[model samples]
Target: MWATGLGSGVRALTTTRFGGHSRPPFDSLNLGIHVGDDPAAVQSNRLSLAGVLPANPVWLNQVHGVDVLQADRVQSDQEPVTADAAVTTRTRQVLAILTADCMPVVLADTRNRILGVAHAGWRGLARGVLAHTVQEMAMRTDGQSRIHAWIGPGIGPDAFQIGPEVRETFLEIDGRLEKFFRRDSSQQGKWLADLPGIARWQLLQLGACDVQWCGLCTMGDPDNRFFSYRRDGQTGRIATLAWIET
Candidate 1:
């Protein structure tokens, strides 16, 4: 587990691909049920994870859109909500975002006890998922609280190669975003995109004053600690979860 150190009363962490009952490719500790891992193994893994949490996390369908759900309002028996982000002001309500290579972002206003988690891929970033999550948290605090964000493990700038259209999507949003992309020296007409850098920029722009990154790369995994979709297309997903410690 990688802790975010969000502060005294906040519990935020991202799970690595270790310590569970999955087989090869999915390996062990695969929390995502949709990734072709054995349902029994995935359930056992989730149960093991719940043993360390204050409550079972509220999972999302994560459509790579800007929709943010209220965790406190969700029913535990209901199916996973179709949203890329979730937020809560209620204590012990854990919000979870699953990802392989996509960035897992956790936000907290320790002052107001507001927590949020987002799954931001290139598409979600361009669609303003981080901004939407920040806005939702702000609404709960009446915009008086200062939000801090932690960007968990993801595909780093050097390992994430993209085409011209992906670069153009961000640039079209803000021409200044060109700084987050650079020509891939090895591949002609390809660009190395900075997923974490862009997320940090967006968080700062959204008034999240303290932005931290795990600085771990999913695709560049030398130890096989993380599950990377780009690195291993058939791999499982690791989860990033956050909640208020009641």
Candidate 2:
């Protein structure tokens, strides 16, 4: 969500489709290589992002699962590890997760020495990606330090209508999760689930208090300021990244 309140030595940002060289569908700043976009154009866009980062981003081949990894353990940039989230205590090790309609959640410890970024869609949320990430990051710090998390833009609750099974997936975890969903009158047997709300609950349960969200809905913006894979079937992905500055 590009929050600065996490304090010094912490750097975080989420990209939109405003600048770069890819053509329509992936138009201009498409940083994801798995989206069928031209490889060179994606590389060019990655370079553009690199200019602002302390080091090259350790991008993930996000699979809507709960797998979380240490950023330094990732062996290659050419072959991104298949994980939905990444965490690191090392400086300049930028942790990145790409998304269009899925939520990107970033976390910072009180000291700003540890950072984590996660990709959470309905599947990942139901599978506990947010919980897994917080557990990984919190384990690195002592009991007294608080964890802060920010929810980056994705398809907001107003636009994220889902089927009954999707709702069931979460309710199965905790009946209290029912508060994050509402019946979708527009679509029979469907509900608009709050992706950010689910993540917020997960974060708070893990003792993260300073949780903030950008409140931007990729599908709701008519101007196409951000990419929306749900609004446009074939589309580029925007990136949300986090890191500790040297």
TM-score: which candidate is best? 1
For lDDT, the strongest prediction is 1
Runs of candidate 2 with Cα error greater than 4 angstroms are 75-78
**Residue range 139-203, candidate 1, lDDT tens digits:** 88755887888999999999999999999999999999999999999989999999999999999
Q: Root-mean-square deviation of each candidate, in angstroms? A: 1.1, 1.6
lDDT of 2 by residue, 1-246 (tens): 365666577889999898889998789899989999999999999899767787788878888999998876764365788899999988878888899999988888866478888999989988889889888887787656567888888899999989999899889999999999999999889899999998888888888868988888999977778899888899999998788885
**What would you estimate as the lDDT of candidate 2?**
0.86
Error of 1 at 224 (Å): 1.0
**Model 2, C-alpha of 170: deviation from truth (Å):** 0.9
Worst 10 residues of 1 by lDDT: 1-10
Q: TM-score for model 1? A: 0.97
CA displacement after TM-score superposition, residue 178 of candidate 2 (Å): 0.8
